[model samples]
Target: MGYAQVNGVRLYYEVSGSGRPLVLLHGGFGSTESFAALRPALLARRRLVAVDLPGHGRTADADRPLRYETMADDVAALVGQLDLGETDLLGYSLGGAVALRLAIQHPRLLRRLVLVSTPFRRRGWYPAVLAAMAAQDERTGERMRGTPAHETYARIAPRPQDWPRLWARSGELMRREYDWSAEVAALTVPTLLVFADADSIPVGHAAEFFGLLGGGHRDGGWDGADRPASRLAVLPGLTHYDILDAPALPAAVLPFLTHPVREPT
Candidate 1:
């Protein structure tokens, strides 16, 4: 475990393996520990930096509400602090959103981008769950019981006490809207979009996001010329929650991270 003080926030991060740097950003309700299963596989080929975003794991909470753009700035500051120039980034769900923002605001800092199960638009369910949890309500948890978020929380969250605060922080972050489609369309780094076949976010939505990637033709209204080199892969038989358990998940991602970026055909 390691800690870096960035913008008055003590960010908790873990490092493993060696080679080109690869930062892992976990989803909401998840900390650096969430990447444990895939870390070893990735570590073999590159250095892995896994961090707990604010309000998760060992990172201290912010004095104000959490926003995705703010979180992206925090990541940008951390990368500069660590002196990791043009490193690869792998972000899951909420983390993916932050990664997209970073790619837009600070494109020079990233060499490649990987997004897992992230939606282009903020979903209503996320805020609804957050509002309920903020009021100390259990209904959202009850509703999420058999869902991917619940299963993911069961695996990554440290304890019961840790959940509410994280949920509250996530709520604050969700309140801030982002133009993900536009930001992603403007990205210049190589990108790999991964989604589970049975993802709760809907395959159509994921496809919509993929279609936005400016690769020769812009299908989602953004300039295709500004689109970065990209690829999209959907894991078969995997649910939003079970994607982490997919044997081919890490394998599918590793090559994309290590390979050189290709020009749009």
Candidate 2:
């Protein structure tokens, strides 16, 4: 376990292995432990840096509401603190949004990027669900359960006292919005997009995200030919949460992380 202070917030992180740096960003309502199952395989060939974003895990609560851009800045600050000028980035769900923000705001800080189960647009249903959960938290003062985000909270943040803050942070992120499509299109770093076949965020939306990139047109789908160096892989039979436990996910991703990106023909 290690720690870095970014923007007056104490961020908890862990480092393992020794090679090119690879930073892992867990989704909203999740902590650094979200990557526990995948870290070993990743660490075998790269130095892994997994962090507890503000208001999650062992990190302290934020003074203000959580926003993707602010979270991105926090990540950039951590990169600078470690002196890892240009490193590979892997983010899951909401964390992926943060990763996208980082690529937009500080492109030079990242060499490669990987996003899993991320949504490009804020859905209409999200805010109501988040608000209901926050209201429940405030009324009963008991943490909610059964949701994918809640499951992550249960696993990563076991302490009872930490629940409300995590819940609040999760709500804050859900309510915040950003225009990531245009920003993503401007990115130059090699990127890999992965989503579960049955993910709540439609696979077609992921396809749209891939199209918005510099190398491809939104009209044409990913045909493999004329595909950008950036690629998208939909893991079959997996849902929003299943990707976390999928047995074959690491194998599917490892190759892409190590394989050098080819220039568009």
Candidate 3:
């Protein structure tokens, strides 16, 4: 576990185990520790490269606003710095969006892509969730002071007092509008979209996103020959907040990473 100077911020990353490199991107307000629960199981099969995004965990914030595209570039830079050629990318929530950006913008850098609990468009979030995001402001930080997210930030962040700034900047980033349908449709690498049965994102969007990746367009013939390279899995009895660390997460995800998809006929 160490820091690397990438895209102007000293990004924190931790590497473990051995095999094909798998980069783990945590959700908003979370750090590498976010995957602590699944690390052991995942490490057994693949080398894990977990990271802390700008302003999260031990990584300090940059002067520029935290945008998915910029963070994606940082991740790409990190990957280059580490000489992790053609690694798999897996991200949860906020990280999911960043991973999507990386896959869309830096296509050649990834072998496989996994996005969890993230939507391609801002409108994909439930109305209430969007409303809550819109209401984020100075007061929002104080309201979150004692919550687990705040506690985690306070505990491990280089500047714990920057929680309010992080919240405000993140709020600004989320408030912006974005749609990546064309980009998702243009992706060439194998992809997987994972979501909870009941997540902040609409269930229909999951199918829609998968469809954009050339999935759900036709029936798989005998021996599943017609399946698209992309896959989707919605785990039961989970929610967006805790789905990342659930046992079912890696159980559903690891096989997709290990098993190669057959070509469509």
lDDT of each: 0.74, 0.76, 0.92
Clashing pairs in 2: none
- Can you write out model 3's per-residue Cα lDDT over 1-265, one digit (the tens) per residue? 9999997899999999999999999998889989989898889899999999998999999999889999999999999999999999999989999999999999999999999999999999999999888787767988899998898889999999898888888889889999999998888889889999999999999999999999999997998878898899999999999898799999988998999875333
Model 1 TM-score, 2 decimals: 0.81
Residue clash pairs of candidate 1:
none
Per-residue CA lDDT of model 1 for 103-149, tens digit only, reads 88888998888988887776512454435534542344454565555
Deviation in Å, model 3, residue 163 alpha carbon: 0.4
> TM-score of the candidate numbered 3?
0.98
Candidate with best TM-score: 3
Query: How many clashes in each candidate?
Result: 0, 0, 0
RMSD (Cα, Å) of candidate 3?
1.2
Q: Model 3 segments beyond 4 Å from truth?
A: 263-265
For candidate 3, the 10 contiguous residues with the lowest summed lDDT are 256-265
Question: What is the full ranking by TM-score, best candidate first?
Answer: 3, 2, 1
| Stretches of candidate 2 exceeding 4 Å from the true structure | 124-160, 214-225, 263-265
